[model samples]
Target: MALAVRQACIRAVIDGYQQAAISGLCPEGAFEAAVDAVRMLDMAAVLQREETAACAAGTENIRREPGSVR
Candidate 1:
């Protein structure tokens, strides 16, 4: 991810923490939830990248098939 995107993600996490703090949730719980959200986001990005790479790899196999038209 670009630096700008990473910074925005960090900003969002901090904002969530602040919102939780204002809503009377305990700091520890809020922190844990915020961290979990970040983890989920990271996982999603990783999955997307892996899917893209797999698709690219599969194309190579397709083009190599004897009857392939590409």
Candidate 2:
């Protein structure tokens, strides 16, 4: 699910770059650089969310374990 969202974000960013390139507003390498930045940000956000979820799940598991006394 997160992967799909990230892929969609990448495609949207690429489309935006292509549109800017078509408008001749972005200089050479600008569109590609923008796309790369967007991709990096998207991946970073997705990974952060995934890590948070994993940590929460791990904590829950530990709390629920049979030997857990607290």
Candidate 3:
């Protein structure tokens, strides 16, 4: 994902948490929940990048090896 998109997502999450708190609807674990949400998002982005890199590498290997197609 692009940096701007990722930043927008993070900002949205933070804004949601702030709105909830301001509306007096915040739960006991609201802070933790927000933190976890952000962490999960970051982890997901990391995993996606890794997966893409791995896939590209795999494709490159197949292209380099003769008779590799099935």
Candidate 4:
């Protein structure tokens, strides 16, 4: 189930990139970079990395008030 969802998401992203490229909106390097990112989209690994980074930054439960900027 998860694999199917992930693959679907990747396909959607790729389709969007291709459409942008066709419209001359996506640069060569940008499209390649996006593809590279999609290739590395591992849900578990990405979540773990993000959790670790958030912990290191001490932003685990940090939040901004309404109308506040980062």
Candidate 4 clashes between residue pairs 3 or more apart in a chain or in different chains: none
Residue 57 in model 2: shift from native, Å? 26
Model 2 spans > 4 angstroms off: 28-70
- What TM-score goes with each of the models? 0.46, 0.38, 0.37, 0.38
- List, residue by residue over 1-70, the lDDT tens digit for candidate 2: 4675666677767776777677676565657755665755666567677788788978877646577677
Leading candidate by TM-score: 1
Error at 3, model 1, angstroms: 0.4
Clashing pairs in 1: none
Model 4 spans > 4 angstroms off:
28-70
| Per-residue lDDT of model 1, residues 1-70, tens digit only | 3554576568668877887778888989789767765665664665567668778988777646577567
Worst 10 residues of 2 by lDDT: 36-45
> Can you write out model 3's per-residue Cα lDDT over 1-66, one digit (the tens) per residue?
466456756875686577667767657556655665565565565657767877897877664456
Clashes of 1: 0
Clash count in backbone of candidate 4: 0
Model 3: runs farther than 4 Å from truth?
A: 28-70
lDDT of each: 0.70, 0.68, 0.65, 0.66
